[model samples]
Target: MSGLIALLDDVAAISKVAAASIDDVAGQAVKASAKAAGAVIDDAAVTPKYVNGFDASRELPIVMRIARGSIFNKVVILLPIALLLSAFAPWLISPLLMIGGAYLCFEGAEKVWHALNPGDGHDSEAHIQGEGGGVSLEESRVAGAVKTDFILSAEIMTIALSAIPVADPLWMKALILLVVAVLITAAVYGFVALVVKADDFGLGLARRGGGMAALGRGIVRFMPGFMKVLTIVGTAAMVWVGGNIVIHGMHELGMHQPYQWIKDTAAAAALAVPQVAGLVNWAVTAFFDGIFGIILGFILIPIATKVINPLIGALRGLFGKTEKAGH
Candidate 1:
């Protein structure tokens, strides 16, 4: 009887340890995931556009495919690479983070510029139809969405990797990143699925009897505005997060003048606000971040459209032209 009791006690103790570890993992995952909020929001905002033109039947599948690709990007590829890099060349993390931050700022600023200009040339897609042959069209749309998801996933994973606690073992870091990746992919795509199907849900409600039907029509009516709101929110988030990342990265790199200046200015503003100093401080910091982001993005715009675009086009042509010649 004594031996059995001891054995049971030991089992209970192990279970408690296991439970604690699980909680630790979950905590770490949430923290890491939060760091990628900008990218995650962009993913949600950007995905709906891809399904815009497609038949209703195709939307969910397309989102699923992309979500799967995003999972693979984070888990199979980015996770391992992040683990290795963290374990070995941790110094490179800041520079790489800065690059990601710059990319986000450029993207966010570009969106703002486009909204202001409303130039006819900016490419934004919403719906994807299966090619005339429904099957091929389906395949193509799925592949395209997956490719786009991969890019966003890369950003998310990098952000999460940067967010992990540096003192943790590589295994712990890897576990945290993996948990974050799975949870984020599920949340993002699940929300996307809901967004994509919303119109159908509304229409179904509009048709059915009772208060629910009226609710459905309202949903349909509301979605267009809702999408517009989402776009604006996503754009703002991108700029704020991107700017903050870049500024912090600069400080980490020992290029502290701009960051220090911004902090001092924000502090001064915060001091002026006697009642809500914290709010003022946050506002001042964000304002400078956004300003810096705009400046950097403006600098990048011309370069992207001119040098980068042409170089990319030329490289594509170089490879494709040869392949064509060979064929």
Candidate 2:
């Protein structure tokens, strides 16, 4: 009887530890997700465009396919790479993160440049319209979107990985990353699904006579403006987050001029509004970081277009020929 009681006590203790570990994983996952908010918002904002012009019935299905591809990108591809880095090459994370950050900055700035200059072969209306191309177009769009998602997912995973404590056990780190991957994928794609389907939902309600009909009409009217707002917010977030990442990376590498200057400026701003000091500090910091991001992004655009892009294309061509020769 005494032995049985001791066994039960031991089991209970193990259960407690397991519960605690699960809690820790959940907490870290949420924290890491928040850290990647810019990428998350951009992912959600950008995904809807892929489904544009599709029939209402096809929109959800297309979203599902993209979501599946995103899941595969994050879990099957990125998670392993992230874990290996964490386990062996942790020092590389910050540099890789900065690269991702620069990409985000470039993307945001390019959008702004295009917006200001319009119709320089960058027309937004060029996306395939009228739903006539069928499965090939759908497949092509999904493939392209998935490819874009891979880059964003890389950023999300790297940011999440960086947010985690280095002293965490390997298994715990793995668990946290796994949770981050699943959570971010679900949240981003889930929002995309809703955004794409919202008009149809609103139309459905509009057909029914009641207060719901008015609400439905209101939703229909609201969607376009809401989409614009979402895009603006996503762009702003990308630059701010990207700038912050690069600044932090530079600080880590002991080049702290802009980071320190930005900090001092933010502190000065915060002093004027003690009641909302935290908000003021953050706003000031984001403002400067965004300015830095814009400058860096503009600098990178010409180099990326005139140099890096052509080089990448040539390398890809070379690799393709080599593979063909081997086969």
Candidate 3:
């Protein structure tokens, strides 16, 4: 009857609304994910090293375990933290983001410093290769990688949360962040899995002994160089994104001098090259951002190495003593 028709119409309207909300979530998720590209690239670039020297059979399994841990870090740990920040302490987001940005800058600059002065012996490659005596090497590597991923995931989630519109409903923000978490974790770790196994794939192709074999040999030869390039790119991205975030955050906090100076300088550079003005502007901006990041990172290096590291070691020692006493 008429009443049945009205009920059906109401249901249809609700369905339409739900569909629109889902679409919004998807769109926002993709946009937010793109905002965290620097961290994503670094994640992909950093992960493969953890599986290095492992048997081919173990590579994929290791990656899967790391990926699972990354998901847990993002979903179970960071997601709720992000939601709580959005709901309660929205004002703190900018400062926390700047802190993360400073970290990126410091990391990138330290790498540059090490590259320029290779005798430092502080490289992670050496640490990763050095055998730890207590636990299985594989377990130690996995634990280290998961710890690293937690930091990167915190950066990713925070960046994504900042990218979402503040006016959006809480549920909408949650949905967008959830989607971003799942998609980004899958993408980074999946690419890492491929990178880790590429050598084996190349070897298999070489064994076939044909035209395809040549391609496989090429892949095998190309992988090391490609990884180096990826690392360099990831490092640069971290510097750029981190520096940019700090600058923007400062601007938001009413310290606009640096941001304005950069903008003006980039505009001048763009005007000098009218044919590729946009490209010129971006290049100039990125250049200055990188420089700023390097400087800030250099400043932080001594503090981190001398102060923060020792403090952390002391705390860990204290906790170990406490636990033993309790036992």
Tens digits of per-residue lDDT for model 1, 153-250 = 77788788888778877777888888999999999999999999999999998889688988998999999999999998888777777788889999
Query: Distance (Å) between predicted and true CA of 155, model 1?
Result: 1.7
Whichever of 1 and 2 has more TM-score, that candidate is 2
Each model's RMSD to truth, in Å?
Answer: 2.7, 2.0, 1.9
List the candidate 3 regions with Cα displacement exceeding 4 Å: 124-127, 130-135, 272-275
- What is the lDDT, from 0 to 100, of the residue 46 in candidate 3? 87
Better model by TM-score: candidate 1 vs candidate 3: 3
TM-scores for all predictions: 0.89, 0.95, 0.94
Residue runs of model 1 more than 4 Å from their true location after superposition: 1-14, 120-133, 271-277, 321-327
Which clashing pairs does model 2 show?
Answer: none
> Per-residue lDDT for 1-327 in model 2, tens only?
999999999999999999999999999999999999989998888889998867889999999999999999999999999999999999999999999999989988887888788867743324433244778889878887888899999999999999999999989998999999999988999899999989999999999968899999999999999999999998889999999999999999999989999999999999999999999999999999999998888898888888998999999999999999999
| Arranged by TM-score, best first | 2, 3, 1
